[model samples]
Target: MTATQDIMNSETLMGLLAGWGITPPLIEHPPLHSCEDADRLLLNRPGTRLKNLFLRDNYGRRHALLLTRSDKQVDLKALSRYVGWSRLGFASADRLRRYLGVEPGHVSMLALVNDREQEVELWLDQELQTGNDFHCHPLRNTATVLLSKTDLQAFTDHTGHTPLWLPVPAS
Candidate 1:
């Protein structure tokens, strides 16, 4: 398959995780487009729910996938200054599909598997590095997978993307 054709979907991601002997807990739910949706549907699920943002520089020459606590209010202006990026803004759905191989609502750290060219930078909230569990989409918003920090690190290492851990600025 061509590189683009090789982009992972939910099944592929699950298979990859299985191959790595890492089977995280999966919870099926209605598609979640926002934190509110998740909160309403994912009742009683254990983990620190995540919010993933696909962002781009003003010129669109650089892209980043930022992962943080779902409840944190992120200030884009302060985040830009903190990261030393040039006026970061939400990337378009087209860019998200092209780089992360996921739709806007399906954005997740696992989608970094599709970034084979390493074109999209990975930014992680340092607060999430605590040994707590994390809730994430397995390439689709229809379900959530509960992963530990070790599982996430193994997946990241497999994908060859090094995450820049930093403090996410709250609004």
Candidate 2:
């Protein structure tokens, strides 16, 4: 929330992507806050979608965006062990704004673009590496973007973010 930056919403996200020459197909729709909402809104356009979680470490010093398929369940203990974090828990709306610049039900990997401090690390499910039809909100829940993994990689690289690929098992 800087003076020059007027809230890192989808418009800002689109501009940033354009600067990087990354054009992700935008699918405009009603605001979708949950996986079920997304599933209902964007029917027949599913492949590898994401559920971005704004998380903090046990002590609340470290933060991360845990991006996994909307279907996969998480085991915090295993995830903590994998990432060497003592424990993992959801961060609050205030913390999300402080770090990733988004609110609850609006958590998306693209929000990482606003993390200029590089404080929120990106943790992605390894299964995402095997998909081409990737969809995610562009910092806003009202719209979604279907982009190639290469473009997503480019965006991540442009943001100086190298995701920690993890194996998120099903529950």
Candidate 3:
């Protein structure tokens, strides 16, 4: 596969993660285009499902992936203060594809693997990792993956990203 194809292909991503020893059980589902859609679809699946916010800094020069629980309402103002982003806004689709190799709803920790430039900062909500189990898209939204938080952390470590834990205030 070409470099771009390798980055964007979900099956390729699955193989790539498996090589890294992240062998989570894959659960297939219909396309989830919104938070409500995901919640409804993955209802029976237990564990901490994250709300990943792909954002751009005030200058649009920096990118960050903020992962918090599905229920928590992220205080973007507070998050910006913690991450040192003077301001934050949703990143464009082009930027998302360029940096993460995934579209908006398809984002997950898996995309960290494609950040060859290491330009994306990962901001994790501290409380979300309380349990050992977690849920995330495997670089695609049509499926869900159940795995250990440690395994996800391992993937991040392997990708050379040390997630910055932000003390996300409770809802």
Candidate 4:
């Protein structure tokens, strides 16, 4: 799995979801590298749009996938304190590929499928728990997948990564 070729792609991700009986709706669009792109292209799409961050502790000993509403601004310093981690920072592109198996722009909770070792921890903004459904990239920036709360939970269970739900401080 060292080569980029080993990373899961959109089709593979969709197949995995289907195998789990979790067939969520997928919408294809131009590649999106930022939340603004998502806002401009998916403005009318239903569900809670999300911003996924792949971060690591200062020492790079731990990794986490933080998910929050796209509009919310997260205070990383406050988040570090809340999670009991030394100053958190965005992980490097190499680290992102090594751990989550996706490049920077393609990160999403669904990428947990690549973490067979269960190394990356999942963290969800408590505020988002109220949403009925959420939108995520299906391991590619060119598409979006709409998943219900139940479907998300099932996906996490299948991946053996239980998310830590917490109130992420907004900057």
Best of the candidates, TM-score: 4
Q: What is the alpha-carbon lDDT for the whole of candidate 3?
A: 0.80
lDDT of each: 0.87, 0.81, 0.80, 0.89
lDDT by residue for model 4 (1-171), tens: 345446777798899899999999888889998899866774578888899999999999999999999888899999999989999999999998898888989988999988888999999999998995788889888888899999999999999999999899999
Per-residue lDDT over 1-171 for candidate 3, one digit per residue giving the tens place of the 0 to 100 score? 125544747788788778888898888889876578976764577676778889898898999898888778877777777767778788999888888888888888788878977989898888875765677888888888886877877888888888888897553
lDDT, candidate 2, 1-171, per-residue tens: 354655677887798798899887888788888888867765557557787878899999999898887887888778888788878888988998878777777878888888876888888898888887577888888788887888878988988888888897565
**Model 3 residue-pair collision total:** 0
Candidate 3 — which residues are off by over 4 angstroms?
A: 1-6
Cα misplacement distance, residue 33 of candidate 4 (Å): 0.7
TM-score for model 4?
0.94
Candidate 2 similarity to native, TM-score: 0.91
Ordered list by lDDT, greatest first: 4, 1, 2, 3
Between candidates 1 and 2, the one scoring higher on lDDT is 1
Report the C-alpha displacement of residue 13, candidate 3, in angstroms: 1.4
Question: What TM-score should be assigned to candidate 1?
Answer: 0.93
Give the Cα error of residue 145 in candidate 2, in Å.
0.6
| Preferred candidate (lDDT higher): 2 or 4 | 4
